[model samples]
Target: MRPTRSVDYRTLAHLRLPPAVSDFIDGGSGDEITLHENTAALRRLRLRPNVLSGTGVPDTSTTVLGTPLATPIAVAPVAYHTLAHPDGETATVRAAGDAGALTVISTFSGQSMEEAARAATGPLWFQLYRFRDRDVTRTLVRRARRAGYAALVLTVDTPVLGRRHRDLRNSFALPPDVRPGNFDADHHTGLRHASPGHSAIARHTTEALEPALGWADVAWLRRITDLPIVLKGVLAPADARRAASEGIDAVIVSNHGGRQLDTTAATIDLLPDVAEAAGGHCEVLFDGGVRDGTDALKALALGARAVMIGRPALWALAAGGGEAVHHLLTLLTEELSDAMALCGRPTLADLDATLLAPATPVCRHTTTARREAP
Candidate 1:
């Protein structure tokens, strides 16, 4: 079937990649309660569209940390796009640049930060999970700056990787053809093999990611670089307020796409509170379960300065590489624009809490009489 939307791309991606690889991209953490809630919460939101409000073409443009985006949709940082396509982050970067969307390249990218930045025609941000070696982490930050990346996305949620049962069952390991180009080859040993019932990523994360990382590191990071700092994976309002006070340029209210820990609150449900807690001191971005234009609109109305799509981008990459991703992004923005026009909101400024109607309550059981099982 021809792909017209992100979900369609997901279907194609599922067919294109190997089963284990597909599961790695699609599955969340244990039980996947948060993953389900993220999409379900957005689906339940009710929009109160104004009628004949003289709305015509809707403006979907917005700026993030002084950078102008043609659309408020941005690509979230995820590792190893090469697992989906051999082009890896390079393809995704070029596609996002062409679509006028910002791309956040992961520390675990299949291509080096320099290569991805060189391929990008638009602004780029580097997503860092601070390594145990402060010097090594600093070197990465310097490299990102030297390569023309505009910001730093400090991901704090993943001190250690979560237990994804799908990967565990599959005993997932990276193929010899793919390596996280950002690091030394010796570092890839864990990625190339896995014992039965053990995902290689669990081994890799243990060896590389820092679990003792603390708020002090955040301050230390602030001391070393002038790049705008965006703290991703924040779900608590207290943390948002603290981030604002600590000079964070933005806080991405995310549950790490429900990949880090299961059953965390859905990002959309917590967005408004997080935004409010920031007290207008910093931008509030969002990630998690944003599937379509209406989903994006719901996030903006709730308080996200922008929304990032992770799995959908991977799905697009699998479906075809950079071109498919570009098409998906273009279609998504058009869907957002269409949604805005229908909601009687003509521009980004027209989006606010008032545009959303109170959510209709959903009962746990059926309201009608139940039929006996046949």
Candidate 2:
């Protein structure tokens, strides 16, 4: 057998991650209907080129959550970076900082939030998983604020952890050895098997996990922290509208990377209506299946102020550690620039629905109907 050459870190990360972690991050709930749809939605978008529009070296600079980002691409918060590499979130933060992109540190990181924040050279946003424990949630928010985080990303989609079978089949545990560094001491508990009737996964996720979180919580959060709050996991237009009305600084159109709800609407498929409902009321960002620069461009064209990449970053980390993650980000930046020049989009603002032709109609009427109902 030929030994694997030291190819690009991108390729390496893609290969290094264990099947269990891959399935956990990549797999969707029952049937993975939405997981497949996220990628399928991307395939259905056709880019239209505006030739001779004087690209003159396209600029990828754009602002997200009122902070100027070198490019509109941010790394999505994926918990337990240590699963990818020993260095964990620290390595990921370093890579993101070097690439001038933002890294949203997961509340469940292997490295403490402070350490990750200190490691990050670029802007940082702390992703909060509001547990049933309001105190824990509040402590995290306060810590993030003190750490100089630019924003607070409340992942509203996961009131309860979604069905992910890989972890179940793998009988995955946090590997008693690998601890979530940021978790308060009291949060730790003994392991329990995931059973069909009892949603072991949901039960395992932060116990005081607030399922009752609503726009009212957003209002409460605003009073507690001055950091701009961006609500992630919003796929419906009405929810998007409600978020805007509740004074959210931004709305991330995501389906929890297709890990939460199985038959949920694809984030890209739902972007148009959500954006329309948003109507410049808030900055609209996107996540879920954004694998490349072109994918980022396509999302921008559909009205996303920025895009977040999930699995790819972890794959890169797993394959080649921090170096691989850095290389992948560089590749994506270069690719986005190239795509922008080719599409004649001088800036993110230049990308719009005009640059894309619907390759196939993404059926979103059911979600839309739900939004319109009394």
Candidate 3:
């Protein structure tokens, strides 16, 4: 049956995916505090609606890093799409293009970057992780550039894989039929493992990823690729400022979907600071806990050029491959349009901080009179 809502796909995915694969996609690091907090934080924000602002149908179209989008939403780079469906990243790209959104292909994608690019009709960006081999990293960057990807999204926060308890408990591994298409035979060998109570991907990451990666590598990447560079996983205002100073094309205010740091501030909570620090020097994109259009609207109001949907895309893919993914994007776009119309925002430009109202927190302390005892 076709799912009517974006979250309905999540339910369908949970039923379709194997336990380990589902856990890998759903679980977060440590106690999963930040994972839940991400959405909770977004829900806590109140939208201040303007009733009489006479506005027609709202225009949802916008651009990020100069790439036009039908809506201010993009599909985030989530590895191993083959785990969700056989077509993998190719299907994802197609769906994103059909929905008039961008797709950021992951470095650990199950489909080759070239294939993903070929499938994409709209803008595409390649998300990068610094590998231990600089030569291999260079090869990937060159491949992305040759494939005509619009930008290189450098994920900076993952020095090492986070301790996801669910993955560990499930002993997560790519099913035999699925493999990382980008890795050559020699590189792929290290990614295979059969250790119980451990994540094979985590072990692969530890051995293959560069833990000592720094800003200098960003310079190295710029010299190697002509494509625009975007720094993802930036949660700090200072880092956003530095990215602007460094002339980076954009910065994604993300916390790896709360998959890395367990108790870190929600991406939306950090968006304002990062946006303020960037100060229009570079574009600010956001990801993490964007489950609906209102959440995307809130992120934009706080100051984000666009937002990315991660798990929801995966859920949609698992539910019914490309078609479901397109449905999910459409739902988000429609919801955002509704939110904009109701908020009196005729266009993306009209969405501002003024549309937001501070959420009231629950107070724990209570006052009582002591005179009754006397």
Candidate 4:
């Protein structure tokens, strides 16, 4: 398929999947105001162009936690890849490896950690959703580390699953043959059974997740593996500062693609504030509403070390599996280079808030060396 833009893949994915399944992938939490705003806020930020500065085709390579990326984009962790295609995380990993981008494997990944790791030709970070049982959570972490994952990305926003009306309307549940390749029958029982009018995903988390998951638990996680710990789902500047002050390696400024909240501030709007709060403390990454390279460039100028593609990657995976995902990222990086050259910022080092219109605030970065995984 000659899909020229990211939305084309989204359209193709909608056509490829069942209506209910597509909605499950596409829909956000109640009202979805936050979901729509995530992208809208980025579009609202006006970029100022610079005159000829001798900048040619821009260089897009950068490092996150000491790992190199061909571009500043990483594949965000989205659940149930096999639900899109049978290859699941294996295909996704291969695509990311080929593009020289990072892949964060969801705890609920459609394939086993071992399988995903084996398929990876690039660095991998495991996104952890801690279970009520410490042992179960610990096991998943050790398994990921053993599988050669680079870091642990603990999702802290979801104390409880949010209300997704689409799942309720569709009564979405995993097909019998497809289950998270990571968990055994004992811990993931809720995933296997679906009740009418309720999403199995909600049931699974309600039954197994730690609703009172707190900062203490984060400390506990820090104690066990010694992997570089990155906190995902942060939107508040105070929370960003706390994470950095507490010795967390990185914090992703995100709103869970508006899937977890109905009316929270858009990630792009919050990024500059969060970046400022965590200034020089830890690397600030971003993960909301990144559809193209220009959107990525805006996020970088706002002080994100990198941006992650969530639904966009899933849509690509659904439309054409791994190949589509690679092509989409390649296009995005090229666009980013084009944008950089146009803005007189030929390299990532040359990006700063001055490239943005006066309405936007500038965020600065000061990063220290990251601790390697043991």
Candidate 5:
């Protein structure tokens, strides 16, 4: 059945995906403390609504890094879309384009960069993971540039893949038919084998990704491609400031969806500090635990240029396909508009820190009045 809400899509995806695959998408590292915290922090923010203010037909449109968006939301890069649907990234990009939203395609995408670019009618950004093979990394960046990707998103958090317990127990590996499309067949052959008690992905990542990757590499990437660079997986205010000083185009304040470095602060909780450090130097995008438009609104109010939806896109894709993904985005956009209208914000610019307040506790006990007062 077609689902009308993001949570419904998640339920459908869970029902359809293999247990191991479901765990891989839904479970985070360690005891999943940070994963849960990401959403919990957002929920703790209370909206200070204005009732009498005449705010009608709120404008949800905005632009990020010169790219116009129908709403302040983008689809975060997720690997192996074929794990969700046959059409994979192609379907996902097409849907995003139709909705006038940006799509960040992952380096581990199940489809080739050229194919995904061809499928997109809107702006596209390529997310990169620095590999041990410098030549291979250069090739990927050049291909993305040639494919017309508007930006390069370098994910910095995973020097090594995080210890995801689910993948370890499930012995997760791409199905025999699935492989990373961006690389030569020989490059990803090791990714196809999963031993009984280990993750083939972890093994492949160990062999391919460079653990010693550093800021120097960011300069190397800049030299390789002219595309604007965005650093993802940054949580510290200092790192955001550093990114801006280094002339990076943007920074995504993320904790890798709490999949890496467990027990870290939530993305939304870290947003305000990171945004302040960025201080208009670069665009600040956010991801982690954004399930609805209200969540997006809170992020925007806290100083995020936009918000990215990760697992929800996969759920919607798995539940239906491109069409369902489009529906999911529309739902969030509508919710953002509703939140803006109800809060007396008639445009994205009108959403600021003033719209937010701390969620306070309610007291149940009341004091008795003295008879002398009468």
Candidate 6:
């Protein structure tokens, strides 16, 4: 087969995968209520650009989890990257690193944490999905820290596997050939029996996924790793407050890319509440439905310290391998810069809630008609 030239990742979703795989990745379960909501919520927010403010050269530079980043964006964790490209996490790290963006390596990555770390030039964070055994979680955390990961992102949204109907209908399973090099077969024994569409590893590995995973667990996890711990998948203001009170480093306001929950508020819609709840006690990051730079800007304007993109990176990698991924990141970063200039916002700090307004007409229809009459 001839090699495909790099195309726009956002525009080239069609070229990325077979129909079955794409559906599994893109489609959510039941009515896909949350899946659609994540994107739909963005439409509800309108950008009210400032014209007179001299944007000059906008500064995208920011620090997330206390680490410097060229842009306030990171790659969210996804499973089985080898399914997208042979290079897997290695290629992902390089692309993200080259762009001076952070890469959050998934717990189920095709490459080991150490392998991905070696390929990175920019900062890296290890995405941790706690398994059944405390030792296992500790082992992974220790490994990530040893491998030079700057922080630990504890994925809190997935307790039980979300119903991904497409994957279920397709009986989606990683072909026997693809595996996460980081885990030994014995270490992941319980996960082996999980049926297609269900992640036994995710399910069997962590028994502490209940509501009991409160301040104590957060404190316990902190005891094990000096690396900053970021709690992912928080939408509730109360929970955000709890996270801040617990002395965690950051919170990733996400909904698991709309995979786990079915009817929750969109991550972006909930961002301001969470940020307010945080009260500047901790940094707030965002993920879910971030397809382009406008989406990134929307989250930033709403008070997200940084934003992460999930499926887009996989689609780009699958579409044309490493170079394609490079192009995809470049496109997004450039788009963000363009957006900032047009809005007359010179830096992320200049972004505020006023930059967002409802796109709908301000006055009622009756009011408009009354004004028009002679």
| TM-scores for candidates 1 onward, in order | 0.96, 0.90, 0.95, 0.94, 0.95, 0.88
* Candidate 1, 1-374: lDDT as tens digits: 87877888887887889999988888888988887778777777778898898898988889999999998899999989999999999999999999999999999899999999989989899999888888889999999999999999999998999888989999999988889889897957789899999999888888877898788999999999999999999888899988988899999999988788998888888999998998889999998989899889999988999999999999999999999999999999999999999989999878999877876455344432111110
How do the residues 115-144 of candidate 6 rate in per-residue lDDT, one tens digit apiece?
Answer: 999999889999987665567778999899
Error of 2 at 2 (Å): 15
| Model 3 whole-model lDDT (C-alpha atoms) | 0.87
Instruction: Give all candidates' CA lDDT scores.
Output: 0.89, 0.78, 0.87, 0.87, 0.87, 0.77
Tens digit of lDDT per residue, candidate 3, span 1-374?
Answer: 67776778878988899878888888899988778778777877778888888877999999888778898889999998998999899999998999999999999999899999888878899999999899989998889989999899999999998898988887887788778888775657655674899888899888889999898998898888778999999999899988898889999999998789789988888899999999999999999888888989999999998999999999999999998899899999999999999999899988999888855453233231101000
- Tens-place lDDT per residue, model 4, 1-374, is 68997878888898888887788788889988888777777877779979779998889999998888888899998998998888899999999899999999999899998999998999999999888989989999999889899999999989888898988877788877678888775657677666888998888888889999999999999999889999999889899889987899999988888889789998998999999999868899998888878889999998999999998888999999999999998988888999999999988978888888986533222122111110
lDDT measured at residue 335 in model 4 versus the true structure, 0 to 100? 85
Put down candidate 2 lDDT per residue, 1-374, tens digits, no spaces: 11122124334544666565565555577777787777667756768789989988888887776677787888999888887789999999999889888899888787899999888888999999776767778999999999999999999988777876666666666655557788654456533344444433455774657877777778878888988999999888899999888888899999987788889987888998999999898989999877677778888899899899887777777877787777778788888899999988888888889888646555554442211000
Clashing pairs in model 5?
none
The candidate that wins on TM-score is 1
Residue-by-residue lDDT tens digits, candidate 5, 217-266:
99899888888999999899989988998999999999988889899998
Q: How far is 199's C-alpha from truth in model 3 (Å)? A: 0.8
Q: Which ten residues in a row have the lowest lDDT in candidate 5?
A: 365-374
For each candidate in turn, give its C-alpha RMSD to the true structure in angstroms. 3.7, 5.8, 6.1, 6.8, 7.0, 6.4
Clashes of each: 0, 8, 0, 0, 0, 5
Those runs of model 4 whose alpha carbons end farther than 4 Å from true positions after fitting are 186-189, 360-374
The collision pairs in model 2 are 12-319, 13-315, 13-319, 131-208, 131-209, 132-208, 132-209, 133-208
Model 2 residue runs over 4 Å out of place are 1-15, 191-201, 358-374
Residue 89 C-alpha lDDT in model 1: 94
Which has the better TM-score: candidate 3, or candidate 6? 3
Worst 10 residues of 6 by lDDT: 365-374
Output the better candidate (3/6) by lDDT: 3
Candidates ranked, most accurate by TM-score first: 1, 3, 5, 4, 2, 6
